[model samples]
Target: MNTNSTEYRLEGDGASIQSLPKISLHDHLDGGLRPQTLIELADEQGLEVPAADADGLAAWFTEQSNSGSLVEYLKTFDLTTAVMQTRAGLARIAREFVHDLAADGVIYGEIRWAPEQHLARGLTLDEAVEAVQEGLEQGADDVRHQGGGIRTGQLITAMRHADRGLEIAELAVRHRDRGVVGFDIAGAEAGFPASRHRTAFDYLASQFMPVTVHAGEADGLESIRSALFDGRALRLGHGVRIAEDLLIERQDDENTYVSLGPVAQWVRDREIALETSPSSNLQTGAITAWGDELVDHPFDLLYQLGFRVTVNTDNRLQSGTSLTRELALLSDAFGYDLDDLETFQLNAAAAAFLPLDDRDELAELIQDGFDEA
Candidate 1:
């Protein structure tokens, strides 16, 4: 058995999970900033920070996010976004985000951030998107120079409660060939259903743009229904709450009898990916329907039922987690082995917004990496 970091090693062989190839589909840009970088940027921008130092600020973020309310969890982003109003800050943050992902063994990642939220300091929507794209390219080049391989794409997000859905959707489409991979609607999931953004979804559908909606996280099954039927999302961000649609008739030591509702069955049979962020899900009360622990997450159930379940670090810093750490926690909670971990990576690769040929290449890469391990 070979072990470096015990927290990120396989239980069976003690192989480093951090060294395995992985894909990220639901990571947030502002939420994944390095603590030191956040402190520096906040100081440079002359903004008041919650804490004077990196460690303190990180602790504050974790505390604030543990309020068990999605609204409260989102409040921490104000500080992160406050420093990201300038192009330099956005580029620097984006570059560092890629570096962090590569260091965590993510071969491919889609970084999502709302462009509209960064326009306070006079950056136009197009400028914001371009700045992030430039930073992503620079970061990828930096990784290549360091003898590491990492590919990244931006998922331009629209704040769900805001009135700029169409504008943000257009922004994503406008930069499709640049660095943007797809479109998403984030922010509060309750009062603002995807129906409010129907026009934007219709436009994206017409343009053949792929979309993933933040549904079934803070809301219930109806929210997921709107995301699929109205937003036409190909994936569900933290859609862990779809388990609410499941009805368990009985369970025995060897077998369990269950029934799937229409929405759950549609998501399962259609193979729409569920981007489950276990720690963040627990912090934001997304899995309150089950229990207050990682073992209570519906991810294993979804996987066992053949749902395309993908693991993710929704907000790395807030959760104090990497993709490696998230996978490790799940493995510990569910007794998963290397093959289960590989399946999750392959599921993410298959659901990535990249083209068919690129996804096929990513799958081959993942398979080869796991074979090496």
Candidate 2:
């Protein structure tokens, strides 16, 4: 791995988190741009950027996303999406995304983004997908040249408030044999639940497409219910609010008693992976019910209760973080050991929207990586 000591590291003494073979199941393609790349892309497109330099731009993204409201926080994506209106921009960013993940020792990753959002420069949905695919393949090559290996897939997302779910789902299935691996619906989660796009989900189901939904992040269990019932989401994007389903029964010297409501129970029984992004959850207030601190996050509770919790960096650039930094923060807050970290990686691998053979291969890779620790 690259010896950038300035890069993030875990707090544990066992091994560097950045060196472990991690898997990113819910990372956003638009949200993981390098600051300098953003500046150059914006300048080339004659678009306005908030900060004058890379450092300032990085700080600006983190600050903007730290706002409490999810809608307010989503405004940062407008900036990232601005310059990504062309094939070149998409390809370059995708290639660099793979390189960054490989540098952080992410052996497998699925980069999700809304194709409709990237069509502003007059490119069609297919064109946008093609550009991203080119970049993803190039990124794989780059990783090999750098003495590392990584496999990436694209998760095409439909904006929930928009009426293009069917189109995006079709687009996703159209490229299933290509780089696309799954489909999702993202956007405002309150009034526009997954139920609003039932036809799209139905169509994707008929096509046998794998799905993950961004639910319970900005909303509560009702939204999560819709994501489960309507969207048939196999995985939840930041389902941290499911903590609301837990009723603290009692606390003794030995352990704490908690009761899981039906929603939590169903999720646990179904073993639906919760794509929990610790830093982004804090910024978006997804874990506000527990508290504002990282330690206050119900990650430990959910983990202890046997929720298929997977650690992720939802937006690497906006959080100014990596998978390494995210795991480190969680460890520092919750006093997790290497075993906890390994479990998170294994959960992500099992929940990945890949073929059975590929999933098993990823599991093996993860086992080998963690065994080194």
Candidate 1 lDDT over residue span 1-373, tens digit each: 1112345788988888999999999999999998889889888878888888888888888888898989999999998899899999999999988888898899999999999999999999999998998889989999999999999999999999999999999989999999889999999899999999999999999999999999999999999999999999899999998999999899999877879999999999999999999999999999998999999999988899889999998998788778998999999999999999999999999999999999999999999999999
Q: List model 2 lDDT by residue over 111-163, tens digit each.
A: 99999999888999999999999999999998898788999999999999999
TM-score of each: 0.98, 0.97
Candidate 2 segments exceeding 4 Å error: 1-12
Screening candidate 1 with a backbone cut-off below 3 angstroms (N, C-alpha, C), the clashing residue pairs are: none
Best by TM-score: 1
lDDT per model, in order?
0.92, 0.91
Q: What value of lDDT does candidate 1 attain over all alpha carbons?
A: 0.92
Clashing pairs in 2: none
